[model samples]
Target chain A: MKYYGGCDAGSTYTKCAIVDETGKLVASVTSRSRINPVLSAQAALDEAVATLDDLKGAKDLAYLIGTGYGRNKVPFADENISEISCHAMGVHVVDPSVKSILDIGGQDVKGIAIDADGTVLNFAMNDKCSAGTGRFFEAMAHAFEMPLDEFSKLSLKAKNVIPITAQCTVFAESEVISLVGEGKPMDEIAAGIQLSVAKRCFVMAKKAAATDSIALTGGCAKNHGLKQAIERVLKIKVVDLPVDPQLMGALGAAEYARQKGLASAKA
Target chain B: MKDLKHLYYLENLLQDANNNLVREAQAGGRLAVGSVCSLIPEVLLSLPGCFPVRLRAPNTGSIDLGTYYMTSMSCECCRALLERAVEGGYKFLDCIIAPDACAQMNRCVENIDLLKLCDKEKFFISYSDVPMKSDETALRHYVKQMRIRVLEQLSGVYGVDVSDAALRAAVLGHNEACRLITAIGEYRKEDNPRITGYEFAVLCTATYCCPKDLLVDKLRETLDELGSRQPDSGKNFRARVVVAGSEIDNPDLIRLIEGSGALVVADRFCFGSLPGRQEIVLNDGEDVLLQICRQYLAWGKCARFMDTAKIEERQSYIDELAKSYHADGIIFEQQKFCDYWGYERALGSRVMRDDYGYPVLSVDLPYAVGTNAQLRTRVQAFVESIEIKNIQGKVTR
Candidate 1:
């Protein structure tokens, strides 16, 4: 009956995942990230705990692990782990067949190579650029005057893939505006944006030598259009996860808490 | 786990380019010769009346003005040095001896000279054409350049002795400090070394920034303290790594790596003790300058050495260090926008990991890594990966 917790305070949102001693996911919740990661973590965990009948509060969990960019600032976390390692473990737990992962988060992009046992073999990350990340998609979505989710889906209806040449987010946004002004189809422009991000991810994946099956994690994983584009670009299968892809980091942290808490108790 | 007695004092010495020791040397009528690259033989500058102080901009928070002048695309370290120069931080220098080894760094020195940052009446800057390939012809060029550019400037401008006897005397003092630093660095090879890498980096960096003669006694004492000092009982580090990279003047990068659970057992970067602190063997049969230039060319591992033999030698040098140090992996890092290291790190990391069969983590970091979470996470993940390889019995070593 013992429970464990994992909170991922990411750039754009805070996600919390809860699991039992056996590593069974009981509840998972997502909340908008606050200015302070500590508050964001507490709010997300409280929302997760509210979904379960047995838990009174986040304190009821036997152990809690904080992860992502704001990991060190999470005051209630018993431990902190990097989001890279967390994503590897979470994807491996959900699907052992995945050997590589492309995690496009709010502000950064990560290409991680993992082994069969959920150990990270190698990783490559974008260097201080927002071109091939969730932020890029959000900017494109804002220019299109639509919700982010609707913007991602619009790419599916594209009849032609227009090439977006700029490798910078600001320049690319300006290019998108010009394309819109030039009276290009909205779906094709959205398709170009997704494909541009997918191409950048491929270069990073090549750095890690990511071959075979890969999975998409982070908030951008919800974008089916981007997933298909990545599959096309990497020429590798993008495996499906039964759980929400955005909860992978939190789930991975929760799994670590369960394993470590049990090991501590036995010791 | 006990700190070295001189650790805090040495750390404070590196805070400013014009530190207490430099001031003391100046007060004692010694000239501070600014040096940029390891290509210029350090002993030649350490002649009787002058000392070599490797240019570094410690705690450089902003390089905006530097970027404005040098453009934002050059090496951050060079930009930071230029920034420090523009702020009149290097006004204490008598003359700067620069080499054409790196174009970006040369630009930094050129900017300093053009702007006349150092207002000392006799202040001058010498830019020499150093050879990249280490051959007999190149050695002759190196000797000639060091004589006309480095040696003649100090002797002519400040009347500092550059005689064979003076050079030999300088070598003796340099050798003494090198022996002490090398002896202290040997402890890192122990199963549980008495010294940490950050402590070693601080000690090593001080030898380069401060006058070598003044640090000899303290280094000797520190070496003695390490001989009997005991490490903490349990293993605090998860993995042992060799950090090979571009100029790492700041020790916080080492501190960050150690904080991420990897112990840096070997430092093969610029300003490190490996080749820089190795003693220069002398003989009565040869000219002191010729011998010194020959030894430095052999020790050249910088990526700027583009010859095929030197290129292969650089990778083998890292392999040799990893084996001798018993390191579990290698971290090949570079300063941002450094063209030489940008190519070298990409090729070297792969060659070490795939061809040499060692786990390698390649990264490009800023000039100063002050509580940088991104770099810390990269290092932590690398340590975990190495640990997992050990557990899985997949580690080749």
Candidate 2:
């Protein structure tokens, strides 16, 4: 059985996903991408390969594709595609009807519109600032003395929502502190922060002219509170995916490698 | 980035334009005329014994003194150029002919005179009005006023007689320089151009800062040097971009865009080499001044003109260029808070993307397109979108 591998070495984390010729995701692994992306990619793939009982070694893989901010830096990969295209491909593989994607990574946010075949039709990115990104939530979590994972859970229990006006992360952190001092409920502030992020993403997505059939991807997609905020702002139901949202880029990269390999073998 | 032989000489001329070339002419009893606008009649200024040097501030950093005189809310370009002048950068200029190119330039000239930035007695400063309307009557008025306000000053104050015969020769020299610069620009028409956008920008910027009489010869040698070189098809550029906006004298910006997998093939800007420099055609028995006035008026439209005809002319010019060059998209770049382009970017991006069916990236950049990571990431994603659109092969709605 032929197999292909894809690695997405993002700024915050690196994920590797392996798929067989039939497009079955056999193994997947994630690890923190510290200083060097190459090491993180290698470790993620190594862990996935080792844990999967039926998998063969590296030499058995037909093709290796890389994606993300450090996509080009992955020395062992056969090809490097942008994470935007990767996310579109990955989303289409799981839910072929998804015409758009919202990917909020640790450092940037992307609003992508895709065609029926998972090819990107149009896209917009917000890398200029950290206003409406995963890093902003991480910074807020650090300030509130809670784990980033608890932000969505805690915010969902709020009865009153207070808006966070500052867009800059540094200024917003201070604003959050002051809001806390004013004796406002922490859950309400968290709910307000998620809404503010959703509003920023809404404007960015509007720039691409994307309207409907959107699926959420990236590490931030796991936050249920942010998902509700996005659905409220866009006024549409976000598409559900079969696999982990963070694994989408890697899955897309592997899908591309598989398609390219099959086309070459036919030729 | 093929380093042509002329690049070295052009770099030296741009670095010390006032001292190396202009001063060499100044020492030989030739007057150096300072010009600020592309609409300025360069052929009239470059008389038999005068050197008409177009003004620009290269790689400018701080503008505290420039801001003190022009204030902080003014255009960045005006401040940068004024900063250099206040620091005694234009010591070689005998007279400054500041045309009312834009709103800020008129005030720049006013500040120069009010502050006596150059020598009060020795330097002769003059302002000539360029008509905003594109009509035969307006063109005629421009010709008449140029002769009275510009030619008369050269003869009366600077003692330089700009005769018809001398003006004809100057037009020929100007045309020769424009011809050679256009030749270098044509090399970029190839699928993978041997000349990168940054190199082309350098060659074009040299036309502004150096003596045209000398630039023509170096351009000829460079064009011949490029003859034996093969077309660069090995580079895997994601898209071909046409940079459209106001005054793009910054070669670093072009370098940054090209560095991000997009090759800049054509541009529509104020001081760029492509649309800015047009080959002047002077017919015998037709007044040379009238022909010069007509060509300068009918050339590329700057952002100041707001009429429907001028708007259509500018859009069609860039669209035709995009079609001919096989450009994949347009990058509309402007300096922050530029008054004219603040409107043009919105209108131009809409027209390019909606009417012409092209991908347009509108970015407001600082004058310095230095290593800003955010800007780089934005450009990278824009180019990637173009690449993916190509792969999709669908005309986006």
TM-score of 2: 0.87
The lDDT values for all models are 0.90, 0.80
**Which DockQ value does candidate 1 get?**
0.58
Ten contiguous residues minimizing lDDT sum, candidate 1 chain B: B368-377
Worst-scoring 10-residue span by lDDT in model 1 chain A: A204-213
Per lDDT, the best of the predicted structures is 1
Name the TM-score of chain A in model 2. 0.95
Which regions of candidate 1 deviate over 4 angstroms?
A50-60, A175-184, A208-212
Estimate the Cα RMSD of every predicted model relative to the unseen true structure: 2.2, 3.7
lDDT of 2 at A59: 45
Model 2 segments beyond 4 Å from truth? A35-61, B8-36, B48-57, B60-97, B104-127, B144-157, B232-238, B372-397
Give the count of colliding residue pairs in each prediction: 0, 0
lDDT of 1 by residue, B1-397 (tens): 8889999999999999999999999999999999988888888889998898999999889889899989989999999999999999999999999999899999999999999999899999998999989999999999999999988988889888899999999999999999999999999998887899999999999999899998888999999998889899998899999999899999988999998889999999998977789999999999989999999999988888989999899899988988888899999999999999999999999899889999999999888678887788888888978987997899875
In terms of TM-score, the best-performing candidate is: 1
Model 2 per-residue lDDT tens digits across residues A107-200 = 8898888767787767777776877777888999988999989876778888878999998999999999999999899999998998899898
